[model samples]
Target chain A: MSIYIDPAVASSLRGFEMPEKLGFGKVMAPVMFRAVCQDGCWSRGELLPYAPLALDPAAKVLHYAQSCFEGMKAYRVQGGGVGLFRPERNAARMVHSAERLCMPPVPESLFMDGVRTVSAYCANLVPANSGESLYLRPFLMGTQPDLSVSTSSTCEFYVIASPSEAYHPGNMRLWVERENARAALGGTGDSKVGGNYAASLLSVARLKERGYDQSLWLNPGNRRTVDELSGMNFFAVLDGELHTPALNGSILEGVTRDSLIELARDLGYRVREREIDIDELLGQVESGRCEEAFACGTAAIISPISVFGDGEREYRPAKAPGPVAERLRAALLDIQEGRAEDRFGWMQAVEAVGE
Target chain B: MSIYIDPAVASSLRGFEMPEKLGFGKVMAPVMFRAVCQDGCWSRGELLPYAPLALDPAAKVLHYAQSCFEGMKAYRVQGGGVGLFRPERNAARMVHSAERLCMPPVPESLFMDGVRTVSAYCANLVPANSGESLYLRPFLMGTQPDLSVSTSSTCEFYVIASPSEAYHPGNMRLWVERENARAALGGTGDSKVGGNYAASLLSVARLKERGYDQSLWLNPGNRRTVDELSGMNFFAVLDGELHTPALNGSILEGVTRDSLIELARDLGYRVREREIDIDELLGQVESGRCEEAFACGTAAIISPISVFGDGEREYRPAKAPGPVAERLRAALLDIQEGRAEDRFGWMQAVEAVGE
Candidate 1:
């Protein structure tokens, strides 16, 4: 569904100026797209200047945490055109996330409209360089101000863009987080809901104290199998093959992780999706059977992990950025940066709307 | 801190009238309280008329779920007075919940002032029934309008109230929630936060479809131990003594649970706080060792559990509102209703500011 843009949007986009230092997601674009859903019927979305929201203090999203969001990027594909990578995946995952929280699912068509509209209008704000792009955050929240725990009957969906530089996930050491599970069994771990992230902050805080950059969360069902990181998916090189956790109920289906799996297969690498038992994996890392491990997400693409620590014991690899991680990162960046073929049909080229 | 009464508050409260039917937390009170915090320092709270909150579209609370809240009541005690039962506990729990999300804590004094001021001004709205009261909801949110996941530097706190009737918790048949966890292990289960409630909504919805009232969550760490109900603490009268899951990291420290333990001990009943394994609990029920069980919180003073359904198996207790639950519910209600003495100093009497 095409959106009817307001006349003021052009002026807002034109008058907007980008900050010199574009942090990860701190700097937002000038224009946004918004839609409302009341009693299961959705209204037509409108593109307007970015503005603060008006909500009752007792809104279910504020008090009950009935909110979910999607993270995707508008890339400056080759030939100076803008496009989005795996936009449909974010839309589908967002639907699942909303269902997990008992909120009405923002339709995939509406989700795409919001993302594509903002991305096309703010194409000038899409950053250059390898990792930098205009990060699009599409979020839906329950707006009915009430004190009950039932499903919210009213909802609002908005797409806000942040002009971001390549998120440089610095040298990372991971802590084998055993005590805290990010999502519980049959919980919203597989869905991208706000509650899952809120539940993870405590573990991330503790891992930061232990001098680790991220916590390698274990599966909540068994507390023995490997789950994804707080915001990314994990990949380890074992026995000359690439291995990642299967899509369990508690692991988010990351877009970046999925792209890498397909790319790895195309590049003639054997990939496996199975449970990585924490104890067994740690032992393999200690014994040199597991050579290198890394994490992948849309924000940073791929970040290599150098060390894995569990309590006092530590496991370090001979190389921080191993050959496999480096090769995969460069391959993915090549496609994203327009330096390679568009054969995989991964990127959807968006027409640039004049500022 | 002394607060200046806003002129608009008087008009809003005067114009507001109780609705014909007051469901739980549905009809909101007209007035509210607000305070701002920056860099660990808090501003004096002001009681103003309740209105829609103005928030940035990219606020961290909406996106990252950096928000926490408390549930409590302000009872219109017998003899023409109003009082709050152990509200300080909620204030402290809100602080802990905020800390878990890395957000600034609402100052204890500021929190107290907000609740008391709202309750004092809206004392007339409190229902005069045995189990009914002015349900007070105190929530703290990260209001900084940025989307990145690090805790917000600026925050806002608000206390809103809802006029309601007695929460008649019928004899509930709980579904043994072996698959879904309300909160994660090492997660925010123990904290009074929005995320935990949102995560539990799915489980509640699924169990309702299966003809169950609420979910009996298991300890996420082991998945075999009994934690508590979604928002209440669990207690069972086994072998003529009160038994509850000990204050494990996963179980919230319910104020009513604490008060009941104290009141029960003083009334010559032995109480034990230990790990209540689910298997052992079911066995005890079958063998006639456990006679009755109940769940307690501010909303429902004491809700008796009638049956436990674990997937294919169903265990019906010999008694629903057994002698223990009946006695405890009456004992607690007497103090709340001002019929009995507040011997433990649990009630804080609030003098109504009548014109």
Candidate 2:
């Protein structure tokens, strides 16, 4: 798919000012990539000036929540280069989410085209800090203006970038949410859709009030096993082995979670994916058998899970951001930032734009 | 609160025509009611022309699925007057949906005023047909233009009306949806939000090809008891008694469902609200103990359920509009259409508009 570059894109990017302080997903890039789909056929992509989109009140995305998005980052590698860490995984996962909503799957090639084009154009905006990078938000929405309870015939896909710091909610404390189940069994739990995130805000808000930074959502199907965090996947080091919840249909198959598993294995750590029952996990954490735990995602690369509070019982891991998390984080970051060799071929380099 | 009357509303209402066919929610009313909210404070309501609403692409509702809605109706009661059928129930339910999405509840008085005021002003437009009325849609959406995944501080609430005939998908053959679920356990299932409806569309579309009118969604928590249809509640007549699923937290508390139960009980029919197991109901239907079944909503009111098509087994009800359903529907319609006494204190009479 050929990209139609608007002549104004360069001026927009050039005139943009980098904010004095960069926070996660707060400061947006100057330009964006947009594409439209009509009757299942997609149009050529465009690199245009960033602007607000016009939507109708009855648009399906506004009402029915027919929206999905992908989060990834373009980083300035240590030795003066730019790279994306497994962007194709995000692209593939977005397709899965779209299909779940009966929306046209954004083709893998188009998905790559959008991300790579945006990353290349916004390369200057890529933060040079070790944890900071240009965060790319690739989103698809159903924009049909109607009140019907059916799939929309028109859709728009856009890739917007936010240049900022790493999403490290340091030494996170979590609340074990029991009253609400995030995604139901046979529901859109595993998909990276806006609805999933929307459904999670209430719980997050409730937990935040109770001095918690996140919620350890249990599997909706059984309400027993540990599914994941709202936007991240969970992992615990039990008896010197890395254990994470298996993909149980309702947990988002996170890109970072997957990379961590492969990297951990290569780093000579035994990683096992299985159903971690909530009760058993709490027990293990309380008994100090589970050394440390953390959550992983594209935006927040790796956040140390400090403690889990379920009702009156509080289970604290032996360490937060312990030796294992620190090591695994370094191993993954090394490949992503080019500090170490791209041994696993996980990093995909993009051509940097001349400022 | 004072209403801002847009002059365009008068013109739009004057131009509206009664279409030859009113298929459910397809036809739109000429006028709509609207109100805005900012940081938990609400603006005065407005009655305006029904037209396209221009919304920002980055609006919270589109990006984060921050929206909720209510479905109710203004009926041509049997006494030749317009009256709303238990609108407060819809108001309470909308509040629940709003809270789920971290939206402030539209005040109960505001909710009642919006529906009643719109209905009274448009009373002349209420269809005079036997099964036709003005279907009202009250929805709230996050209107802030931002890409962040948090509750929008600014929101807009609207009540739009559409006069329509009965939603009679005659002799509905329902597909037992075992794989895909409409809402997650801790998800938005209990709330009448857009995401819940959008999630169920794929299943309905798939089943439509299989000659089914709707998909009978099971409870997402325990894939056991019946949850509901996309926008309606389910009912079954077993061994000459009225039965419906109890208000498990996951199922929406439907106004029509509540009304029907009361009507059935008042008419001296044995009404039971409890779990209706899918397999057991199928077995009962097959063995002829379950005489009939139907679905109910504000638009459809009461639609006969004919066949329950599970993948391997199909249970066809002996009677579609069974005796119990017919009796209950007639009694409710009589009260709604002015053909009987308003004995149960259900109807709220709206001011009649001069032709």
Candidate 3:
């Protein structure tokens, strides 16, 4: 793949040192990939030193939130290689998200070039741990310096990598967000857009004041069905069956959620994608029928849910890290870390740039 | 105002030349006002040359939509002076918007200093016309350079000016949007946040394709009652009585909308702030009871609505610019432009710098 390599990028990468404490999304890699689009035409991708972006004060993304992003990981394989897990899905999902905001999509080829180039150069940054990986964030934002509430004529796309440890929120306690809705019914809920995350911050802050780890958002339409937990998808194991919310336009179609659904079925567990009502799930937890619950996303593969706080009541699940969650997590990690056969054909291997 | 004025600001302002044709929000002023906040403590404001903001790629606002903004105007007032129309209202509203996004609120003093300083320096940019003014945009955004989904500890506040003609979508053809919602039941509808604008863009784009000038969004909860236009408030003259949407949590309490309601009442018209259902409004329009309709905002003071397009049908009001709309618009403009008596105390006179 032919791409522009900034002269300073090699030096930046060579001079950088990884931080000792690699918390999630904290330690940034030295280099990044970038491309621009103007009037629906995309420019070639480039690898440059990671630096601050000069955006006009009136840039559409700054004022109107015309931005979308994807979260994926590049892992250090057992055989001293770097691998991306189903990056094509993130590329396609980003296209959908951009279209929803009336933005020009970054073509699949350019998207691949961005992720692959960044990962190849940052191969040493990929953490060689059971759960840790180099977190890659591919984002696109409208850059046109106009204040009108219209589609921007120009856009910027970037791929930035963070060398980090696995995000583990131990056994989490979730507060049922009854007052605030994360996304509207026909809003940007299904897209990986900035607006959805921004809307969730206040709710999360309120819940945190009450000693909760995250807010369990309910569907905006009914305010009863479980939508999601900020960024991650929710799951519950009831009667040895895995149940999660369906893709109802208001829930983000999380890649980790999809992979877990597929992996659970392959492991002989009954997986169902249906509307899991919050009240019903809470009742099941109260009755001990819901054995375990967890949230899944690329950043945190699977985080166990210990308690659900609703109003003045608390409902605890039968198990925090239940048997089903443990088995599925181990199986997924085995494939991701290259400890097991790549039977699912999920990993895409990339050669290191300096190798 | 004891604010630090950059030396380059005077040069930038002196070099700026107003264009031949001034369109709304298109031609930006040469200088801007800025202030920074760290952990809720605001720094002194500064007036500087308008330039691109250098933001980190991982800034909270860039990826999380943690931004809010206010739209007010500095008008060429009587006696060759400049005045702001109800800027305190905008300041309060912006504080609300910032708090809704879990961001530190811009202090009222700092907010006033920013807007007033920008307006004072750009006094010459205030277009001397009946319907035109120097559009002042005061915005706040989270600027902390961290990728974690949390509130930013640091923020930046800016006041940018645009000199332009009045935004007049003369006799707008509105589409009754039944599908897309601008906001949710418990979402940031009342707050002037970026997410609400981003969500409404697609609906507006779709309506424009169908020969409609704007979309008349409905309540996200019922999808039946009239909410407002994307950035404007909805009003209808029903049986010679002015009616607009009440201050529901899902409706942005538009500054212009509130002023119009107050002005209409003062002008001896029966003002009613109640819910207006879409079906009932269309039926009234069909029966000729709803004589006129219009939308109101800071940029477009009062834009008449000519038609409402629902699926397969169009409802034309009896009067596009009805007597009531005209009277209210003229009365409001008179107060805003300093032609009418300052009975409401809505105008704040500002002394031009270097006068």
In terms of lDDT, model 1 sits at 0.88
Which has the greatest TM-score? 3
| Alpha-carbon TM-score of each model against the true structure | 0.96, 0.94, 0.99
Worst lDDT 10-window in candidate 2 chain B: B54-63
Off by over 4 Å in 3: none
Native contacts, share recovered per candidate = 0.85, 0.67, 0.85
- Comparing 2 and 3 on lDDT, the stronger one: 3
lDDT of 2 at B39: 98
Please identify model 2 stretches exceeding 4 Å from their true place: A7-11, A79-81, A352-355, B14-21, B77-81, B120-125, B145-148, B352-355
The per-model DockQ list reads: 0.76, 0.58, 0.88
Question: What does candidate 3's lDDT look like per residue over B1-355, in tens digits?
Answer: 4799999987898888899998888889999899999998888899999999999898989899999999999988877899998898999999899989999888899999998899888888899988899999999999997889999999999999999898887999999999888788889999999989889889988888899988898999988888999899999988789899888888999999988888888878898889898998899999998989999998888999999999999999988888877888888888888889989889999889874
DockQ of 1: 0.76
B1-355 per-residue lDDT for model 1 (tens digits): 7875788988888888898788789889999999888877788788888888889998888987889899999998989789999888988999899989888888788888988989999988998777888999999988888776667778899989999888876999999898888887778888988888899998899889989999999998788898999889999999899999998888999999998999888888999999999999999998889999889988888999999999889887788989888888899989988999999888898877545
For residues A1-355, could you state the per-residue lDDT of candidate 1 as single tens digits?
5687999998999899999999888898999899999999999999999888889998989988899999999988777889888799999999899988988899999998999899999988998776889999999999898888767889999999999998878657999987877777767789888888877777788788878899899987788889999899999999879999999888999999999999998988999999999899888888999988999998988888889999899997655688888898889988877888867888888888894
Candidate 2's residue-wise lDDT over A1-355, tens digit each?
5789999999999899999888777677888899999999999999998887766556678678888888888999988778998888989999998998889999999999999999999999999988899888888989886666889899999998889787777899999988777777777888887777778889988888889988889877777889998888999999999999999788889889999998899889999999999898888988999989999987777899888999987888989989999998888887889989988888898997757
Predicted complex 3: DockQ: 0.88
Model 3, range A1-355, lDDT digits (tens) per residue? Answer: 4899999988898899887898988788999899999998888899999999999999999999999999999998998899999999999999999999999999999999999999999998898877899999999999998889999999999999899898888999999999998789999999999998898998988888899999999999988899899889999999999999999999999999999999999999999999998998999999999989999888888999999999999999989988888898888888888998988899999999963
Candidate 3 chain A, poorest ten consecutive residues by summed lDDT: A18-27
